[model samples]
Target: MKRTFTEGLGRKELAEIKACTQCRECLRYCPVQEVTGRVEISPSEKIRIYRDFIERTESLRALITGRDIPEQLLKDFTRAVFECTTCGVCGEVCPAGIDTQRLWPLLRREMVKRGLGPVGGQAEMPEVIRNTGNPYNQPPSERYRPWFPDETEIAEKAEVAYYVGCTGAYQAQPMVRGDVLILKAIGIEFTMLKEEEEVCCGFPLFITGQHELLEGLVKRLVDAYKNKGVKELVCSCPCCVNMMAKDWPFYYGKELPFKIVHVTQYALKAIKTGKLRIDHGLEERLIYHDPCYLSRGVGVIKEPRDVLRSIPGVELIEFDRWGRLSRCCGAGGAARKVFHDNAVAIARLSIDEACHRGADRLVLSCPACYEKVNDAMKDYPKKVRIVDIMELLSEIIYGQNA
Candidate 1:
């Protein structure tokens, strides 16, 4: 395979790919490969195909042959590439430390260049984000409503501020409600941005490779918090917290002035310190599915579990694959758009694991994971309930209090 088509590799990208020793040690641990059992679709194989495209210019003949690659082929490739739940398991298992987690996105950028990128629902997000600053394409005014109905007041200069990411604003409305209930239950003093001043967290932009737009949005968010004297930031979305905590500092020259905490961590703190009293006695065999952005991206496996454990009579059964090694639900990196089947396949694997463990309910933290995995379980044997952890907490608290 005279491998000679490296056109997209700049000095940095070339150095990274060249560093690969072609050690297949990572193959043993990749969940996708483990599920599919095909080397051609493995991360290493994907990279090899990329290298061949870069090194062997002759491979361009595939495109030049004037034979249209079936939309399904492109869709499958995009799904396979982006389907990585970003578990970082392969990186932990790799002897050479190839860092496929980072490499996958770079490869996706190249894939997008060939118009073979994420399909279906995700296909429209990049354009929506670029145009309206949010993936849902709703008016920004629709974004600024207080997460709670009427109890909390917008402060002029609060010590803490809540950064409701896009999912919090739109998809995961219950999470927003849960957050408001917890804050109100504890009497924590925080102010939310007026509806007109709130902005998207730009996570959709970053994942879609809209770097320029992302940078601008990050600046806008950082400045908004800084100007408002927000010393702490509370977020309900793990993706938003991960980006603000890690990627923002890396991409921007400065660290954000405000500290970031996911709703789980904040809720746990309140419960532990007696700020909030949650009534226990929810008897259910619950399995917690760690969202990739929270567990692997931010090392937050225990906090969510700790909260679940606090509920009296709540039995938290550990899945065979969990924490940093959690299997993806097939929605991350726009995989739901590119590879709908692969996403469903991955979600099916997770559902089976939960069922095998005898879980009556599946608790998730990410809105995307909740939606994708829930959809996958439609044809599942048992009726497994998919719910956000916050939703469960709200139910437990309200049920007990009421």
Candidate 2:
């Protein structure tokens, strides 16, 4: 059932778009709107434009008046449609209670019908997921690069298997290293899927509206895990954890044999039970940026902070906005690709808050947030360090050498 553009904007979507009275209240609260200051660029304004385009009579009249929409406008619309991080910040402050996040996806499905979807880096992501079982198009054998050869062998026979996502495997190498190190320090027996056996968790695909392809990927992943007789599925990527733990069952119509846990949660459990030990001290002030997926998406707020608090000599400072209400670093939903400037603006907003708090470092749990925030800080006046929770924990538990 390929969705058509008109089919995507059914009554529900149309009503949401139509319900917007152009109050401009959402405009004042929008992070992007604040930076850009373009009323037409605000989330509500964009939805109104989309609604007008859907209206046949208005679209034709605009075209006849030489105000016909241009290809770039369409492209811009397509980009803006999915550019939102879906952080719910807009809805949180929306006086009209309009759900822009939900509206954006429905709008995006129509854009996809027009061959305008999955913009920028996400353009080829669905195809990669369809073929490689992951978006990186890397062989499953690559998944084991994070583990020592000896540990790999041990993992094969272990009761729990740690799924190191693509970012953990390739981009954030330290995260993978830290996860293995912490697991080993805790003496937790876990196996790793050999490179050829690993698959992408299909979050990008699921979010991008390639919902039909999800079942096959989910089936393949669940089958592989079940065959290992693994009791737990631990991962460092919160997106992967959300996909495997929550989304997979929705697509596959069955609960996976293994339970899913983010590595942070596991680390917190180990620390509390005295299974893992930390001897390091942090004398500097630290502020935790709740990754949208980790805190708001899954509500795993306490564990990461708890782990931070367990460290000696570290002061955890709260921003005026924190926890589920925390602002986004602006890299999610392929926003960085489509609207790079807007994404950076959002990232800078978060960074400005961190600087205002007078913190020496910005601690994050999500790899996406870590990457975006680090990039955003490059132009800032202050020299604040951005660190992933795993990297910080590893430094504390394993020392500088580890």
Candidate 3:
């Protein structure tokens, strides 16, 4: 059964759609617009297109004549929404305070149910996760054992549990490895799920708007942690953390048994408690790239910078658009899989800015940004060292290259 244009949207979303003034202020900050220069795909244009569809489908004329929206118009809207990184900058800049990040996915969810979306390679994610327990379709056995630090001990059950999100476990191993190394260095007793016991957190599916599997996946993961007696859950991936904190309960139908905190937030707490020490220092200038999900999705804007600043003899550089207004690294919204060229192009914008700012290292916290920005670093005329905050800290403290 196909839903009407206005279905699935709540009062807030409806008012947001109705509130779009088409002021176009968000266009200047949109990374997609900055790179593609396609006004048709701009945020304001997307809202306009959706709003028009709602009016057309609901109008009295449509009921009398059995009118239908044009196929090309729907196709254009689908492409426009999926092409976005869902970075939420549009929402941050919206004069009417429309939450475009949240709105875009709801819009995409409607389209997905109508057999009209999850554009390009994104449509394959749900099936891939189902078959292999991850969006990357990699074997589950290879998730953590390959990179587990031998000397570190994982408690059989602990109050704190670390979630090695799919991206960090499979793609950016060094980042999660550093996470464990830091945990052990702080002497924090933490537990982890067995390699095969952990599954996708459903962020890929959620962001792409293929949400049928989200509830099952969320329940399974949440129950696993609950059985472990986990009081707090720590994750390095912002996408996973945001999903757990914001949407997991909606699916679980109650408050979660545990709290979810980012690795940076956890590490900062350790530092403040004197459980973790920044014993080593790097004498170099560094710029931190705030991952969109971490900075905006969860309002974790201060912890990462505070962690970076704690190290001795390090100068931190800020991107002109930092914190809530940070630019997307282009890998978000599942866009990188389909818009490979655009993903790299948008990532280069950040790298270019980092290099031009004369930073020796460009530090990142999210695995998605870590992977995509590193890919963008290749074949570029200039280079800035890309390192995850965990990796950088592990190297600084342990005196070994992470």
Candidate 4:
């Protein structure tokens, strides 16, 4: 329903902006600032710039007077805004309750409208999504091939549909296999859209201010799932779950036909009800890395940890920045794809944290975290075992054959 930057910037946002004490609490929690060590990218800094711009533009009646803002202003605004991962840590720590998480994207959307943004590596994303069903720009057939169990049965028309996100299909194919295995093992009937028929859930597009193409992309997905009589929409990726559960309804101003449930939520219930059992649980000192989308985006902090703890003999520990304070793995918001080196630098911080904490393994639920962090740990083989939660479960259920 929030269609424009102006609508998002009205009274509530203004009050939050005006009330900022600039205690720098947000900086302490920001992963981008932590990685870059730049005051320019701090949430406080962005807030200050935005407020100054708003005051000047409004005072001069720039909207109606045909006044021109400086090009350098737009360039600086774009850099400060886009460089941030928008992990919602600012909202969590802000004393003034400023929703910088929402504000940043809205600001980015305004930048795009003014022809200022989708900076760095994100500029080509819209065209890529339009041409391909997913973001990796891989062919549809390549995405359709199953990477998990070859014998897993997927129902044709089930009340439950597994919305395997683009990350699951492409980047972390094994995680998709693991998620499907878990669903089947739990005696849940589910269906997945064929890759050719699959359209992205549009989190990448939405966060980067490509709203113009997002509505149609999401609506096509919603209508297809709705037509199939699916009542429960289950997702393995937190990014997709967050967008489908929050963004779709908020942006479209309509309730979804089916409910959105993260795969961990479903797996947690299965564990409690005795439907899901891990007979051969691995004994390892592991830590659960909370993906920003699930924890801060959709408030799914507990379920992932609970799922990990449910496995017998898994000694779970916490990262220095876990749960609400979790550091981004530097993959979300198209950061890894757009700003590759900087994104990896951000990811390295978490990898170093896991190493310092002496965790034998890092259990990640989000495909973004799994891919980004796993890639970061490629050379540091002795540091920690980075495995997706679903993949870990599949191993327990199916043994080495999995």
Best by lDDT: 3
- Name the weakest run of 10 consecutive residues (lDDT summed) in model 1: 1-10
Clash count list over all predictions: 15, 6, 0, 2
Off by over 4 Å in 4: 1-8, 60-68, 146-148, 379-382
lDDT of 2: 0.74
> Model 2, 301: alpha-carbon shift in Å?
1.3
Superposed model 3: Cα runs more than 4 Å off = 61-66
lDDT of each: 0.72, 0.74, 0.92, 0.82
Q: lDDT by residue for model 4 over 1-402, one digit each (tens)? A: 323334446687778778888789888888787777888878888888777776656655656654455779768878889888877888888888888767777888888877888887677778888998777788877775757467777788889998888888888887888898899899988887777878888888888987878888888888788888899999989889988988888665699888999999999999999999877777888888899889988889999889888888889989877887788888877767667776788788888878888888888898888888878766655457788999889888988678
lDDT of 1 by residue, 80-125 (tens): 6666545456665666666665567666666666667644565677
Lowest lDDT 10-mer window, candidate 3?
58-67
Model 1 stretches with alpha carbons more than 4 Å out:
1-16, 19-25, 28-31, 34-38, 53-87, 111-124, 144-147, 400-402
Residue 175, model 2: lDDT of 61
lDDT for residue 298 in candidate 3, whole number 0-100: 97
RMSD of 3: 1.2
In angstroms, how far off is 129's CA in candidate 1?
1.8
Task: Provide C-alpha RMSD values for all models, in order.
Answer: 4.7, 4.0, 1.2, 2.9
- Model 4's alpha-carbon lDDT is 0.82
